[model samples]
Target: MSLEKIKTVTLADVSINNKGEYGIGASAVDYSDELYTYLRITDINDDGTLNKNDLKSVDDVDAKNYLLNENDVVFARTGNSTGKAYYYDKMDGELVYAGFLIKFSLDSSKINPKFMKYYVLSKDYKGWVNSMCTGSTRPNINAKMYGNMELILPPREQQDFLVNILGEIDNKIEINKMINKNLEKTLITIFNSWFINFENYDNSKGMKIDDSYGEIPVDWSVEMLEDYVDFVTGVEPGSKNYHEKPEPNDIPFLRVGDLGSRDNGVFIDPSLSKNKILKYDDIVLSLDATIGIVKMGLEGAYSTGMRKLVIKNDNINQPFLYCLVKSNRIQRIIETFATGTTILHAGKSIKHMNFVLSDKKTMDDFGKIGNPIISIILTNLKEIEYLTNLRDTLLPKLMSGEIDVSEVNCDLELKYNYMKYLFNQIHTPMSKSVV
Candidate 1:
């Protein structure tokens, strides 16, 4: 690593224009297969990745004018999301960025534009954003201001090397993410048939009964959710205690928005928390705004907006509880409990909710089948978090030329093999066919 190899340049120096182009001022229509996907500021995650769960489309005739290309990087210019970005990936399909975003098309001849995307995710660049936007009520970075933002970049050859390495890590993360997505979907389906609907197993066809919830196997009964599970709300260790970098004794502070990934952009001292520390594959649900987002990952302290469903009774079956929390019936009920204007908060609605329990043998059998699938999903999630942390750790060092990754083997086939081996490690015979 050499200081001479690094150069200082304004964002505009590597971009097409001094001021980046504004996006379409159009509302999101219901998703249209024929129309371009409408990307709002809300669509960009804290890590500079696009949120794919609620993808909508723009039906405007001028939607094509706002279309993003592979070379373009869009920035969120206003409010709490100021400086947030989303790099257009073709895999996301053709996208039309909203007006709140500023599109910066890289001048490929100057430097690799993708470098800036990773740079934005770096602590240095984020620090600059904080410095620039300090003391603003409604923080906003207009297009010209974004263009004026400076970048300290590595030499062109070094830029390419860093890009390839970082890109490989990201691609691997995406692969693991997709694997977990499919795994969760499969697990939920299996849970529904085996426990919820009682349709898949031989014992499922046994005597049935219609009750408060619905029709269920005769041996299955509904119990108050609170009776079997201790609903533990998370601890909030003050904003002053929150730090971005992971130091000793610090764990990720899982917020409502952080249910998707382990990296919530901040960490807090776990010792500060008197509440229950999360375990791997723990059933957790968002009890606040954007309610009912159930996910299992991250052994960390969580925010007040979340609830960890700790099973006090061993007979309840953890996997069954997981599937029950993820089910549509539970989701709808949780949503109904949420109340607020901008930020909805769910009360102790678990008291009002019912947990359907099957016969001990049936519950045990379902756990046997479902636990492995949950384990696979959890494995992939942990891997995704591991890879993401690896990439994030390497990003700043690589960008600042403190470390050189030029000799790294980042070839496509090698990356593919590495990902294959990771997936191959924990996969069961059932997981093989389910996937």
Candidate 2:
């Protein structure tokens, strides 16, 4: 199939109402406790999904015009992310897009929105858009420029087939995301019940008591955090000492800022030497600007600036420990311990901190419950990594007509089911809550 056969379409062709003149004006409004779903550049993840935490609501009508629905594919038509796109899904109420965001609907017949979304998110498309973008002080791409941009479209059936295959992968990715979210929440809830609220008996061991919150669970005891784990501050390798280039197979060096919520851990950049490595299963805690953010290093070298918490006991499950540290309860403790002006700094002496510890049986039970979920999470992560690599491999080949899409099987149901099972395990007795 010739590349030209898949006609070049544009945002104008697929959208119903291409109202270019509509602009969200700057209007000031009071910030309220009731959060209105607002979309910002930061909300758009590199993977093309919107992060709900990026929501911000203002008590202004003008701010409300940018409201979006579940299927709405918002285009970042201006600023640094001029051509970036995001598909809003599982969002509730009225969602207003930022001034920089341009709203558009997908023509399902001519183009699959997901496929179009993937196209727009492609490196080649982004590079082209970036090159075409105008504006001196602040880079911006107008609606006209967006409409003028071309896209390669296949037959409706083929488009659907491709979208369905990719969509299955995406659905599983989303499911895994939800599982991780619930796992995180569950861990947080457990932490809150055990540590923060100090649920359970007898606090006579030189510690204060507070039972005002709620009922206490039996077999739980409160103790200082120093008794459980040892905290070690990371040493900073000066910028000059860091190497910018290394072999492709070199160990990944993770930075404090590179910690992403998606993986529940930090990804190592494979440009660092093996000599500067942190041991496997070591808890990587972000202590600098973003304190209390925890992730486990999976067999690689990492920066010394990001604090590493080494689990003192062999029996203590490192994964569970990592999850506990990243829990909101622990975050609150770290916040309270933090002391600094501009940047919130978690104190080096986290040893004095206190927590409620459960019996070994309970800890083991909790670990067991978390084990499968963690396994599923890790599997989904590995699958995502695989899909990413596969997609990257196939993209150029498919685009260049080196490998025919006709030859590839698009039966995604099998893969989808496997992924869904992993998701369903964690989301059993599922709540309507969007995680």
1-435 in candidate 1: lDDT tens per residue? 678878899988888865599998988988878878899987887878778778899988898988899789998899988888887888878889999999999888998878987988998888988987899999989988989899998888778877877788888888987888787778788888877667854665576656676666666777888888888888878889888766775666777767653233577776877855677767888888778887776577778888888889777787888888878887777877777889988765676688677778878887888788878888887677666656666677678876664655677556444544443453311110001
Model 1 ranges off by over 4 Å: 17-19, 201-209, 240-252, 260-271, 405-435
**What C-alpha lDDT do the candidate models reach, one value each?**
0.77, 0.58
lDDT (Cα, tens digit) per residue for candidate 2, span 143-251: 7777767766665555655556556666666677677678767766765554455553345533534353243445555566666676665444445544444334434
Q: In lDDT terms, which candidate is top? A: 1
